[model samples]
Target chain A: MIDLLYFAWVRERIGLPRERVETGAATVAELVEELRAREERYALAFADLSSLRVALDQELAEFDAPLAGVREVAFFPPMTGG
Target chain B: MRVLVQAAPFDFGAEAQAFADGAAGAGAIVTFTGLVRDLSGALTAMEIEHYPGMTERAIAAIAEEARQRWHLIDALAIHRHGRLRPAEPIMMVATAAVHRAEAFAAAEFLMDYLKSRAPFWKKEVTAQGADWVAARDADEAALGRW
Candidate 1:
């Protein structure tokens, strides 16, 4: 099982902050595809991939990055920190 | 180096003094504080959200990079999350080095990275409603200079 987390508008849209899901997806992109196909809310939150950012196990990563030993995945828009 | 991600307010004056005092050999210290902007007078508060585990890790990495690149004697960053009233301080960064030039440059570098690279999101709350603050292209561009 992989832990999925969301923040900001993504969390608002998804209606929850975190969840555990069991999946066989090989990469972050595949995992996203699986999520987008699960329901309308997921589809809407991930409608535009270009506007989103992803992190694997607390580190920023690319969509195509493999998720072999990854345990946590976060999805959110570009950060406005400082 | 010290990185603090907290929900409570911090004393900037005291933090700067402590950081400076800790760096006995340092000749220069630069500190920058960021406050929530009211702008049009409609903003009631600013809500900041951050990834818990990632926030600290990301900041420590940034601070370490600054320390190595500038050969800083010491550095400190404090960022506040949760609801913040207009004009309230949102965050602060301080850098100490052997000279003024290095201290100033490192502080700027830390600010630039913290703006875009850190994992914090901000929302502006006005009397009318609350809205997420979109990331600006200029902020992303600022990173290119470094």
Candidate 2:
């Protein structure tokens, strides 16, 4: 099992801050697709990948990044930090 | 270099003084503090959320970059997460160098990186409702300069 985390609006939509997911996906994009199929909230939150950012194992990564040994994944909207 | 990510409010004056005092070999010290702007009085409060482990790591990486590009004696970055009010200090970056130009440039570089690359999100709450502040394209473009 891997840890899946959400922040900001993604957290609001998914209604959970974090979860343990057991998946067979090979890439982050495939994992996202798996999540989208699980619930409508995930589908809605992930409708637009351009507006979202993803982190794999605490590092920023692309959707097509390999998830073979990744332990944690976080999804969130574009950061507005200062 | 030092990076602090906390939820409690920080004292800008004391922190600035401390940073300045600790830079023994520096001739110039610069500090920049970001305040919550409540323009038009529509904003009641601001809520900042951040990724726990990534927040500190991202900030430290930015500080490291600044140190490499400039002749800095020391540098510190402090950012707060959670509820903040209008005019409250949201974050501060302090840089010390042998000259004013290096200090100023490093501080600006740190600010630009913090605004774009850091994994922090802010939401503005007003009497009408609340909304997540959109990330400005200008911020992303600003990073390309360095």
Candidate 3:
């Protein structure tokens, strides 16, 4: 199981900030695919992979990053900080 | 280098002064304050959200890079999260160095990284409604120069 965190619009669409998911996915992309299959909300939030950014265990990572031993995964829109 | 991520309002003038004073033997001190700009009368407030631990770590790494690239005597970055009003200060970056060039460059670099690399997200609330601020391509491109 891993903590899945959503922020900003992703959170609004998913209607929750975070959740714990039990998965056997090998990569972040595989996990995304599993989540997308679970419900329509996840599918909508992740409809376009280009529009979303992911962080593995609090560090910016690519979708293909391995999830082994990872504890947290955050999905959000591109950062708009200053 | 020092990085502060908080929801509370910060005293810009006092913080800038203190940062400058703390850098012993530095001849140049440059500070940039980012304000929540509202051009239209409709804008009421801006809400900023961030991942706590990552926010601090990312900012500290950016500050460290600035310190390594420039001959800065000291550097400080302060960013605020949560609901904020127009004209309110959103963040500040200050750099102290022996020369103005290093101070200015480091401060600019800090701003650039803080915009794209940091984990904060912003939502702008107007009289009509609230919307998440879109990330700009220009912000991402700005990183290429450095």
Please report the candidate that would top lDDT against the real structure: 1
lDDT of candidate 2 over B1-146, digit per residue (tens):
87999999999999999898899999999999999998878899999999999999999998998998897999999999999999999999999999999999999999999998899999999999999999999999999998
Error of 3 at A48 (Å): 0.7
Candidate lDDT values, in order: 0.96, 0.95, 0.94
For candidate 2, give the lDDT of residue B30: 94
**Interface alpha-carbon RMSD, every candidate:** 0.5, 0.6, 0.5
Best by DockQ: 1
- lDDT by residue (B38-137, candidate 3, tens digit) is 9787789999999888999999998988998897899999999999999999999999999999999999999999999899999999978999999999
Chain A of model 1, TM-score against the native? 0.98
The count of backbone overlaps in candidate 2 is 0
Task: Give one digit per residue, the lDDT tens place, for model 2 in A16-40.
Answer: 9999989999999999999999989
Model 1, which residues run further than 4 Å from truth?
A: none
lDDT of 3 by residue, A1-82 (tens): 8999999999999999999989999999999999999999999999998999999888999999999999999999999999
Off by over 4 Å in 2: none
Per-candidate TM-scores read 0.99, 0.98, 0.98
Task: Point to the candidate with the largest TM-score.
Answer: 1
> Which residue window of length 10 is worst by lDDT in model 1 chain A?
A42-51
Worst ten in a row by lDDT for model 1 chain B: B36-45
Each prediction's Cα RMSD? Answer: 0.6, 0.8, 0.8
